[model samples]
Target: AGGQGEGNGLTQLPCPLGLVVDQLGTIYVTDDGNHRIMRWPKGATQGSVIVGGNGGGGQSNQLNGPVGLSFDRHDCDHCEENTDWVLASEPLSHSFQTVKLTHHLLWTVDTNQ
Candidate 1:
């Protein structure tokens, strides 16, 4: 889903750290350098940001050094249902944030708590 260099563009990835694929082969990538999560559908040359595209920060819409990702299976059995939640690890913020598949910020869990 990325090209030759790091960038915020659909075909670029800057320091991509982690990724997960759904049952339908849609790939979800954690773009750490860009502080966003990218969704790349199978057979697509480009991808779209599904979370934290507003640069690195502590805000609900931002992600600081998002390093890891996993799908929360307890909420939904399938990713295509748009009811599954993505758990993202934000090392820079010392927290984990949950983003619904519909691209909504659900909540954040502070590791320090």
Candidate 2:
């Protein structure tokens, strides 16, 4: 088995804060340094901008010093498929937020908000 710079087919991603693999083999990228999570779906060439917050002196729906991320599609814990969401930790925000994945991927429902 080969991966990451294996053949130019895939390369090492930067600041991968989180990781997940679906049955379809799609790659979810969380560029923590860049303050965004991009999708590198299977057989894709470029990363698709999925989620990101103000990367500067700001705090928005994207993230605020976002450190962790995860994706779940099932209805669970105050959420459903309609509210399938991503979970991330923000030190600046001093809390965590459950983000809507089915929506704009930016819709977040924060317990501390």
**What TM-score, computed on C-alpha atoms, does each candidate reach?**
0.65, 0.48
Could you give candidate 1's per-residue lDDT for residues 36-76 as a string of tens digits? 87878889889888777787765566667776665544322
Q: Which ten residues in a row have the lowest lDDT in candidate 1?
A: 74-83
Best by lDDT: 1
Q: Candidate 2 lDDT, tens digit per residue, 1-113? A: 11353221224444555555544676665555555555566787665555553362233344444444444343121111112344454322335455545443343243522
lDDT of 2 at 73: 45
lDDT of 1: 0.63
Scanning candidate 2 in windows of ten residues, the lowest lDDT window is 74-83
Report lDDT per candidate. 0.63, 0.44
- Candidate 2 segments whose C-alpha is farther than 4 A from its true place: 1-13, 53-58, 73-113
TM-score, candidate number 2: 0.48
